[model samples]
Target: MTSLNPRLGLFRDQHVVRLAAILALLLIFFAIVKPKNFFGLATWQSMAIQFPEFGLMALGVMLAMVIGGIDLSVVGIANMTAIGSALLMLQIAPVGSDASTGYLALAAAIGLSLVIGALAGALNGILVAKVRIPAILVTLGTFELFTGIAVIVSGGKPTSGLPPQYAEVMASRLFGVIPMPLIIFIIGAVLVGLLMYKSAFGTKLYMLGSNETAAQFSGLKTTSLIIRTYMISGVLASLAGLVMLANYNSAKADYGSTYTLLAVLIVVLGGVNPNGGSGRLSGVILAVVVLQVLSSLLNTFPNISNFYRPLIWGGVLLLVIVVNQWGKNNNLARLFRWKGNAS
Candidate 1:
């Protein structure tokens, strides 16, 4: 058994290997196609800037997925939170105001956004856990509900008149080249990774996902963990929304509508089991980086129309699904054969 353990470890860890392979492939492809652009610090910085919000959204989705659930409402929540921040900023610091006042207004806007996000998440959690509705149905309902509120509040118009400081903070370089958004993303990933991987609550989440009945039988608080997972997702989505507002210097009701599919793609591409119970943050981080690099590559190639991006993304998703199924089947076959031999 000990002799076979190392071989089993290799198979168990194949997801990690695949993630690294994808990243390496992306780097090689970018280097070949856009040598000059791909190697520049400016290009790297731009890629870093593009990641934070999408990464955060992906993180939220990953957490829900790990708990054997999904949150289709994250994009809607982000959009609504972004609009809420914009509206609050406008109310507190009209068209013109002193920089200090603008800063305070921004702070207030963030607080309001967080509160709104938490409420939305809580509602979704209650519907799923207490009301005994499937997460898919609950989140899908809120997706539309939140987006509707966002459109009504923004009047289908882009928000402007943001204070200059917002842009300065978003675009600022720390230590000469690190963008503020990238720094925020790193911090978020580290903190959330620790919470999900190192804490007792995280273990409970995995146990619930693996088998809710067993977790409950073992005296785990499954319902509370599920609710808390969604709540955390909501908070992270709201934070992403704020970053988007600051980075773009404008907000729109539909700002995050396109991110819904992207977030799911990242989670799946990261090798997270769709049926849940097993995954890692490292794979997710690599997947996000790979996708961002792919986006950058596509952006550099002017001839590759933006309309085709979705098609490419869809194809990649299909491939990932196929690969996951194949891996699972192979593992199951091996496990059964081993059991038969032991018998």
Candidate 2:
């Protein structure tokens, strides 16, 4: 009992530890309830392939939240960048092109798409940081603007018939055991971790999020930091776009339309403070897996409709927020103390 107390205290204080335990419990529950569906390699592989799209977007959302801002335009940026990439692919390597030419075109399209994402993000930064508009209002307006641009560019239709090379490389596994999307997600997470944990930029970002006035008085370039943060987010969103284009073998204006809400939910569920200045990348990553597992668990129930997913997600988000509020007030710890005494 004495030994267990330390672990219990650790779990109480560490968001990542709590998230990991919840993830484990969820996986075990699913396995028990639907062994045929959840105990197989196919289920896990499918989750690995599918979650990276929105998981990357969630990371972008996490960055924005960390800096005391929000980016509602991530889905819009992702879809728009994908649409642009698809259009570029059609022009550079039409059907009947050789595989080498298709690969070259794919590379060029990815670069250009990232550039577009950066520019779009920069625009949001300027509106929020320089124009003195609220972050929520700026991103809300740009969300519609970017989505509108995507619709116009794609002519309100799915852009398809691109070279097979894009999907082949993106959807293909490296060794027939691991997934390509999973690999890309790992790389992206690593880069973000380094940027946030190992650099001066990350220090400045936390400072700014904690108190913008203090940061400004301390001689930090608040505007530039905010702009760069959003730029990184845009790049991440664009990367997700490339992955989406590969996964679906096409692009559209409305792909992953529900992801904006999902991203915010994931960030908050990961124990990120919505008001900003405190979060862990590990917690966010774990939350992504936990949500994916939950989603998969839902799919195992044939009677459950897909439309209820958003409802479930919203409920879970609200519960997390309520719990976090309790934690902030130390009420959650008091409840734990009461339980411990009763035990």
Candidate 3:
């Protein structure tokens, strides 16, 4: 009889295995609690609608985390972009009866938002990488600064008067049943997945995260990579903001305030190391879906009390972190160690 390879017996990476287990458990929980709602097209559609915007933000957070940095400024970028897009769209639309002008204005708004996002991200990169500042402190400061700017610009008012065509495009189905935002989410996930997993830059990022000094000695342009990562994060967050603005048919200065923590939660919960160096975009995508499902299930319980949502979210986040650490450090490793000693 051939001897089995111990590594082959289990998934090569225990984190991946744990993530799969969590996914399975979530499915089972939903199946038991809300059998009909768990697998319905409507439920899926609802989740699809809500996930894309946050999913985009989470993708950015994943990239930053993979690079051993954090982008707390993302929520700020998102809010700024959202309000900027709304304001630009309003300005560009013709006053009386020019549909073509409205379309032109919408295009301008999107382009402007993308540019602003890139600039904002670049600024963050410069601060953290070139200025030699700690990412957490820099981003926290900018988080407040950017949000304050957004508030000043919006004056605490909800944006409205978007073109009808814009609203329709945002709300309309791509094919027959698929929501456009959901499709955007899928595309973003795939692209980010490829960028993070299959590209040279991705390798550099992982290397940098694993050891910055070693990466620098190895000839990696660490500073440039850091800048690029934040830029990408900023652009993604802005794109998500646009999707959100369209979906809600409004924009506010605080549109993405609650998302900073949520993004961190998703990235860590998706099996990305909070300390950086190892993570998968696919895992993040699955985590987003799982979270959306959990949120939907909670929503179905009318008397469950809305105030508990954050508490539950926090609890789940804490559980994921503890379980992830235990899986990596204690349970799985100890099992392998015991098997090795016995052998």
Name the candidate that leads on TM-score: 2
- Ordering by lDDT: 2, 1, 3
Q: Which ten residues in a row have the lowest lDDT in candidate 1?
A: 1-10
Predicted candidate 3 versus true structure: per-residue lDDT over 107-220, tens digit per residue = 888898889999899999999999999899988988888788888999988888787667677677877789988887788787886786568888888888888999999999
- Which stretches in model 1 have alpha-carbon errors above 4 Å? 1-12, 331-343
Could you tell me the TM-score of candidate 2? Answer: 0.92
lDDT of each: 0.82, 0.88, 0.81
lDDT of 1 by residue, 99-207 (tens): 8878888788878888888888888888888898999999999999988998898998998888766676656889878988888889889888788656887777777
Listed in order, each prediction's TM-score against the native is: 0.91, 0.92, 0.89
The alpha-carbon deviation from the true structure for residue 221 of candidate 3, after best TM-score superposition, in angstroms, is: 0.8
Candidate 3 off by > 4 Å: 1-11, 94-96, 326-343
lDDT of 1 at 31: 95
CA error at residue 39 for candidate 1, angstroms: 1.6
Candidate 2 lDDT, tens digit per residue, 245-283? 988889999999889889999998887778777777877
